[model samples]
Structure formats: structure tokens, C-alpha cells
Target: MILRDVSFAVAPGESLAIVGSSGSGKSTLLGLLAGLDVPTRGSVSLNGIDIFALDEDGRARLRGELAGFVFQSFQLLPALNALENVMLPLELAGAKDARQRAEHSLAQVGLSARSLHRPQHLSGGEQQRVALARAFVTRPRILFADEPTGNLDHATGAQVIELMLELNRAQGTTLILVTHDVALAGRCGRQLRLEAGSVVQ
Candidate 1:
């Protein structure tokens, strides 16, 4: 098993950071929390609902309705431009104003001018901004980021961190992130340290 005996709860509107060395189960724990992977012997509750009790489709619907994700790799589709990428989740949810909401989200991330650019055409920081835009456009109740700044340089990473924190505060969205950066972890209201697939701190 990649993770063992890991249990924690995040209050609404709070920020929590999961910190660990490489291979310490940080990403695995995140996957479990996001309901992308099921736990073998435990439960994950979100918004007071036990996600593991639901079937795969049920859990997926829950995620779409209540959660957002940002990854280190900036998982924007290669075929779509920034606006289309950000608009995807909203469209998937059948929102009537997806285009408008997507444009607003991109503007919030300082990507208004780059909205027409594809991920491959933008800089790393710009691409990550697009990813952030996509994550928040749904106005999700919780946001999960896995190594969100891992691919950026120091200065660019700092900018992304600031923007994420700002958005979290502004929207009152619960934030959970996994990272190796001590400074990033420090910015969070609470920190959980993991070692050997267990909470060590």
C-alpha cells in the first residue's frame, strides 16, 4: 500500500498542507482525499458524506460538483486553448454561462491576454495560471493541488502561491495541497508531515 494509517480532517474555508519527502505517499494520500483512488481499509468524508460508500460514478459526480484540482503538470488539454480549457468543467456541469465564467476566471489569474494561447504556447507560469483558472472556475467547495508549484522557478512559484492563497481567501474555498517546499507549506494554516505512508507530525 502506498499510504497507511493516514487520517485528518479539514474544516471549511481552512488551508492544509501535506508535506513529505519524495515517495513518502504525499501524492497517494492526495489521491485518496480527492476520491480519485479508493482506500482499502478506511474512509474519506467530504462535506460530511463518506465518499468511499459511493460507487465510482457517484464519487465522480461528487467530485465534479464539489471539488477542484490543480496538478504540477498543468493538465490542460493539448488541443484546447486556455479559454476552452478553463471552460471545460463548467460546460461539463451544464452551466449556462460557461464562457463568461471562464473568461472571468482567466482574468482573475492575470491570463486575459493569454486566453487564446494553447498550453504549449504559453510559459510554464502562464500554463499553471491557466490550470488555476480551470480549478476555480467551477467555484468548488474545496480545491486540491498536488505539487502546484513544483515545475516553476522560485520567483514564478512564489507568484502562483500568492495568487492561490488570494483566491482561497477571496472565495472561502477549502484548500488542500501537497508539496515539498517548506515555504509553501508554511503559508498554510495547518501542516501535516508524512513519513513512510503515515502522519509523522
Candidate 2:
């Protein structure tokens, strides 16, 4: 499989939006950059480290150290409550105060009242808020969000977007967002247009 020779860079503390129609390879590009997926050709680098040169375990370590992700589908573990879902990563990272950190992060997303509620018990917007808490709990240097607002109504989506930008601003975390929404794309600081698996702009 060819990677189609696309190249781009996101500055630290910047927000870059990737926009295109469906099937335009926006998600693939994101996966490669975030080290979630590998490319057959070329390479990906983050913070001066070449990702493609790393073995799988090395890449996994890099992801844990550098990246956070939010998806359109709230990929929360069904059995875990909001707090538990947010605690998962912190625990995995061996943080001694995982529960405390998780609680704070959930509260940051305004889900403190629903901490005991499982994903199924929460509404769409609430579920996404839980996801947002989980994504930021690690305080990752970079975040990749794929259509984070795709599952919400317009008003709810706007609120979610606002929270995301707020966190990005406060933490100076680099953000790369993939979306088909033109209005959402405009809100980002930089825009990359993709077509046929290549950056067109």
C-alpha cells in the first residue's frame, strides 16, 4: 500500500483542522500522524522523533507519552462508569493518584454529577464529555480528534467544540481535528484540505 506522499507539520500549541469529503483519507492521515496506524511508505515524526523508524512497542511508548485521542464514537468501556473510564489511562500509566486525577478531569468536563453513571446511562453529549475527560486526563502534548462532534446535535456539538478549544488554549496542547463540517473547520487556527489521500492545500 502506498501512502500517497503527503506531508505536513503541526506546530506545538497550534490547532490544525483536516477537512475533506468522506473517503478522502482524512482519518488515515490522522492515524499515521498520531502513530495509531503505520504507513507503507514515507514516515511520520513528532517533536523531532521519527515515528516510522520505531518498532511497534516503541511507537506504543511514544503514543503513551505524547498523544491523546477523542473519537466520534465514544469508545468508553461499557462496564466502566464515567470516573472509571477516565481513570483507565492514568492507572495504566501507573499514576499513584489515578482516582483523584480522574475525578478532577471528569469535573473539568462538567461530568462530576455523572461520575457513577455508565456510558449507556448518559446522553450523547454527556458521553462525549466523559470521552473528553478521558482524553485529557493524561495531559498529552498532542490530541487527535476525529469528528468529535459528529454524533451530536448542532447546539451540543458547539458546546463540545468550545470545551475542546478551551482545554487546548489552557494547556497549549497541539490539536489536530478531522471533520467535514465547514464551520468547525473555520474555527481551527490552520486548515489542511485533503483529496485522494493527499494534501491539496
Give per-candidate clash totals: 0, 0
Candidate 2 lDDT by residue in tens digits, 1-201: 424768777899999999988888999888989888877678888989999899999999989998999999989999999999999999999999999999999889998999999999999999999999999999999999999999999999999999999999988999999998777788899999888787786
RMSD of 2: 1.1
Error of 1 at 13 (Å): 0.6
Clashing pairs in 2: none
The candidate 2 region of ten consecutive residues with least summed lDDT is 1-10
User: Model 1, 67-159: lDDT tens per residue?
Assistant: 999999999999999999999999999999999999999999999999999999999999999999999999999999999999999999999
Per-prediction TM-score: 0.98, 0.97
- Residue 134, candidate 1: Cα error in Å is 0.4
Q: Over 4 Å off in model 1, which ranges?
A: none
TM-score, candidate number 1: 0.98
